[model samples]
Target: MERSRIAVAGASGLIGGALVRALTADGHEVVRLVRGAARAADEVRWDPERGSVDADGLAGCGAVVNLAGAGVGDRRWTPAYKARLRASRVRGTAALAEAVAALPEEVRPRVLLNGSAIGYYGETGGRTVDESAPPGEGFLPGLCVEWEAAAAPAREAGVRTVFARTGLVVARGGGAWGRLFPLFRAGLGGRLGDGRQYWSFIALHDEVAALRHLLDTEGLSGPFNLTAPYPATNREITETMARVLHRPALFAVPAPVLRTVLGEMAGDVLGSARVVPARLLESGFRFAFPRIEEAVRAAL
Candidate 1:
């Protein structure tokens, strides 16, 4: 791949950090978008809350990846927290999109890869969905719709814009998998709810690779579900983790208990989504760990 300067927002995040490392290893110049001020030579100041960013800092970059957002599982889904979630994503994306659009045509980045999630297809039940699927009903789906739309400025400016509809990433240190590793190792791992909810997951390595694919691939725009081809049920995941860790999967978190403890967040935890990476496959991006077993071993 040709080397070029790339500006990345949310550089401190789990996914963002991994992507930065991969990009830097591949000889790309990475400019991190910081919230306060440019503390380092490679850092650029940007305030999503105020919809402000340093346009001068972004000039001549090949791509601008906006991964800035409040974590979904970071806190309870109180009304205020929900608002903050939406604002964090939408505002940051809009700020970057507008900034990219304002740049001179000759210097403007060629692409804008914005962060998104498979939550757009909320509670698919048993149905398998792909990028062609319409947005599901409820808060998460609505938030995703708005989040992707927040990049209108970049799209309208003729910059290739892509929405990474990522799934539950299987990794060692962060994301949902981070919390699961300890419990499973201690023999406290169990299925959530009925253990029938489908989880579309991808290994962290493949997740980062798919993002890089989108960033580099020409003529690729719109949404792409970054998930393994075959999604597994919560029960399957529990069993796999137990077997891999040599622990017992004898416990189960009842639906009522999860609801009581997790509140509105319980819906997402217990909900089902059997998503596939149709566009990613069509684009010829291959996965290193397409199977749940392979992903589990890699995480371990």
Candidate 2:
């Protein structure tokens, strides 16, 4: 692969951090867009909330990956929290898109990979969905809709745009897996709700690889479902984790309890989405860990 100059927003987050490391390892010049003062040689200050960024930092960059956004699962879904969630993604993405659009044609990055989520599909029960599937209804889908729309400026500016509709990313260091480790180790891990709802997931390594692939593969565009080919149910994931850690998976969290504890946010944890990486697979992308058991074992 040819060495390229890549500017990445939200370089401090989980996926962003991994992407930075991956890009650096691949011999690319990485410019990190920070919110405050420049912390290092490659760091550039950018305030998305104010739509301010260093144009000089983005000059001559071959690609820009916007991973900036508020954490959806970080708190309960209060009305104010929901507004913040929507604004965080929309405003931040629009800021990057506007910055990229404002750049000179010759210096502007040729591609922009914006982040999205599989929650766009809402609760699909056990039915399998792909990139071609229509956006589902509800808060998550609405948020994703606006989030992707915020990147329209880049697309209109002739930059190839790719919206990564990510699924549950499982990693040992952080994310969902880390949060559930204690419960699983204590033998209190179990399925959420009825355990029949499908849960789409991807290994962190695969997630990183897919992003790299999107950056390299010029023909790819639009919404790409970033998930393993095989999407398992909640029960399956709990069972796999239990088996992998040598624990019991008998204790299941009832839906009512989850709703009471998590409020509207509980639907996210209990909902089912059997998402498939149709576009990715059709494009010849191979998954490192396609099965739930293998992914959980490796992650553990």
Candidate 1 residues 18-62, lDDT tens each?
999999999999999998879887999998867789999999999
lDDT per residue, candidate 2, 181-284, as tens digits? 78899988999998998889999889999999999998788999999999998888898898889989889889999999999989889889999999999988
Residue 57, candidate 1: alpha-carbon lDDT: 94
The TM-score that candidate 1 achieves is: 0.99
TM-scores, all candidates, are: 0.99, 0.97
Q: Please, what is the whole-model Cα lDDT of each candidate in the order they appear?
A: 0.94, 0.89
lDDT of 2 at 237: 89
TM-score of 2: 0.97
**For model 2, where is the 10-residue window of minimal lDDT?**
47-56
